[model samples]
Target: MNDADLVDNLTALESLLQVTFHDRTLLRRAITHHSCCPDTAVHDSYDTLEFLGDAIISAHVVEYIYRTHPDASEGEMTAVKSEVVSRRVLAQVGQQLGLFPFICVDIANLRTFNERSRDSLCADVLEAIVGAIHIDQGTEVAREFVTRTVFPMIELVSTHAIDTNPKGRLQKVVLQRTGHLPRYRVLEQSGRHNDRVFLVGVFEQEQLIATGKASSIKEAGRLAAREALQLLQKKDKRSSADDTTA
Candidate 1:
């Protein structure tokens, strides 16, 4: 984007973020995708800022969880912090803020971007902005921004327990019921390397209980584990009813 357009975007973003930048260039770099932009410097991108922001976000999230959940176990606090600082959650915040429009990038690349790629970019941009805020303003202001945007997720995490590791949960269930651990196997894979999809199956004692499909093997495994847990729960209910009838 040209200087005029960049200024307009920055002004609008400032209104959204509720913080004005003393160094406009910092904000510009935060929103600049590595894709070609005539007015942006070749080296100007969110890469470095995103690295710094990742660390800042993790630290703040850890601190927030530690303070708010005094009685929470260390494992629980770590899980909560992981979910809060996750790329998925950060991308959600960026999408809510309507941040994509302000990002300077090659139009061609933007047009071809897929959902996963777009989300990754949004997450990176969110962190980059935090980094820029830290540099241009100060740690206190940046912390305030994180508190407003990311800390709210703590309640959601607590309510849903979405941070619980699905594989671990399933393994515990399986071990208790059958004295064996659940196993995951890659059933199939498709799509190109950059946009691959995986199908995974969870087995209990050599029996395929459930399957899941996702963009990554790890996610696919989690999905399969969740399905297997539900299947096991249903079976347990049936067995309990049969025993009662007996």
Candidate 2:
């Protein structure tokens, strides 16, 4: 994007975020996607800002949980915090802000092409915004931003005991075992809007591990991840038994 377009995007984003940036350049960097921009000396992309935002999110959310849920157990607190800081929730918040329209990215390599990439990109940009805001305004402003947007999700997480992070869990398993992340592909979608069924297939290095179906794609992906983990567990058990016998 040209300087003029960049300024226009920054203006739109600021309006959406309801904050004025003291460091306009910082705000610009937050929305700059590495896939579409030139690398700088200190950083090539939002990676650095995203890292800072992740830490800031954790610390702020932890403080919120500690203060508000004093009677909660360690496990309860852990669960709630996890949901609040999860990629899914972060991405949801980003989508609500409608930041995709203002993001600077390569047309062909757009994050909107794939569901996974879109969610990840949105979450990353949201985090980058948080990081930029903290740097430009201060921790207080950043905390307020998160408290208004991300903190309320805690209620939904606490109400639902089952976590919808199978993809994340399966990702760890695949990375540890084969040095690759598991992939989720949408196989089929059926039914009406209020009662739709989605079938998602989980693949490890091009081989299909399992397929899952649910009312929502996210739930279906989680089911597929669980199946993949079980398969790995069985394989591990067999290997352990073989070793013992030998």
Candidate 3:
């Protein structure tokens, strides 16, 4: 977009964010992509702001989880925090607010914006905006902004909040059963590089106990481990019942 169009878009974005900037330049830089910036030598892009925003978002999320869930375990709070501040969730929030259209990326870069890349861009921009708010308004306003935008995401994870470290739990189970740790192997992979899906199997010795599918291998492996853990626990209960009857 041209300068006038960009200015108008920024004005609309300010309304969306519900905070007008004292230094409008900060907001502009926050939405700027490095590819669009002429001076490569000068850091006039969103990278630093994104970093600052990440910290700000994390702090607020951790604090919120701590205060709200006093009876929750540390691991439970961490899982909730991880879900709240995750890139995927942040991108979803940005998408909900229609933030991607305001990003100042080059036309060339725009062509490469697939769904996965667009999500990544949205996530980065969300953080940069938070960073900009922190700098322009102050911590109190930034905290309020995060609380308003991000606190609601807790519902997305709350219903499914189990142990996030499923792999660690699976390892202990495998060690107890067979005196060897479980291993994961990719059973299937498909789709493009930026959005590939993986089907992973969790094995105990030569037996493939369970499998899980997801976009990332690490997540897929964790899922497989969770499934395997559940399967093993059920078998153990069955065995105890059989022994009692015998």
Candidate 4:
């Protein structure tokens, strides 16, 4: 894209972000990915802006959550923070904002598109946008941007624990409750080459409670573990009610 096109694009982004940039160059730098060029001297990349934005994002998020949830304990706050700042969460946010089409990547030599790398790039750009907003506006504006955009996304995904590492969260809960960790095992593998599929089961005390299937083993395991976690939560609630009545 030429200078004029770049300027138009940045303007559109600023409108979408609801913040104008004082230094339009900073906004440009925030959207540019390093993979677009081999030279480190390139000014049109989000890496440096991403670095600055990350700190700003963290501080803003922590402060918002700290004030919003005064009754929440430190451990709860930490867990919530981890969920909010996680790469997966950020990538989802980027995807929601349709940022991938604007991204410039160097993929000519690669055999396949690296989803993880793409996600990271998206996450970095989100952070860079945050940085640009902070620069263009004030800290209060930046904080509002973070609260309005990032926090709502986090909360939406957090409800019902959808699209999150529920197994990991459940494991922590289980460890605190029973002092025993859950385990996962591959039940079956099928298909050929790139079309492979895996089935996994989650177990506690050698008794299987949930099973899931996915294209990747890790995904299957996570799904199964999440199912197991849900079941365990239901059982725990029932047991607690029974004890209370007794």
| Structure candidate 4, residue pairs in collision | 32-46
For candidate 4, give the lDDT: 0.75
Residue 182 of candidate 1: its Cα lDDT? 86
Candidate 3 segments exceeding 4 Å error: 107-111, 162-246
True-vs-predicted CA distance for residue 168, candidate 4, Å: 17
TM-score for each model: 0.62, 0.62, 0.63, 0.60
Model 2: per-residue Cα lDDT over 111-201, one tens digit each:
3567777777889989998999999999999999888778888656644533455566667667876898888999999999899999999
What TM-score does candidate 4 reach? 0.60
Q: Residue 132 lDDT in model 1?
A: 94
What residue pairs clash in candidate 2, if any at all?
A: none
- The best candidate by lDDT is 3
RMSD of each: 13.4, 16.4, 13.3, 10.8
Which residue runs of candidate 2 sit more than 4 Å off their true CA positions? 41-44, 107-112, 162-246
Mind giving the per-residue lDDT tens digits that candidate 3 earns over 1-246? 788987898899999999999999899999988878868614789989999999999998888677555435677788888988899999999898889988888858465768998889899999999999999999999989998888789755643553466787678667877899898899999999898999999999989999999999999998888787666656765776788799
Q: lDDT of candidate 1 vs native?
A: 0.82
lDDT of 1 by residue, 12-118 (tens): 99999999999888998899887755454455888889989999989998887775554355776777778878889999888888888887767685657788777
* Model 1 CA deviation exceeding 4 Å by range: 37-43, 107-112, 162-246
* CA error at residue 81 for candidate 2, angstroms: 0.8
**Which candidate leads in TM-score?**
3
Q: Could you tally the backbone clashes for each prediction?
A: 0, 0, 0, 1
Error of 3 at 192 (Å): 51
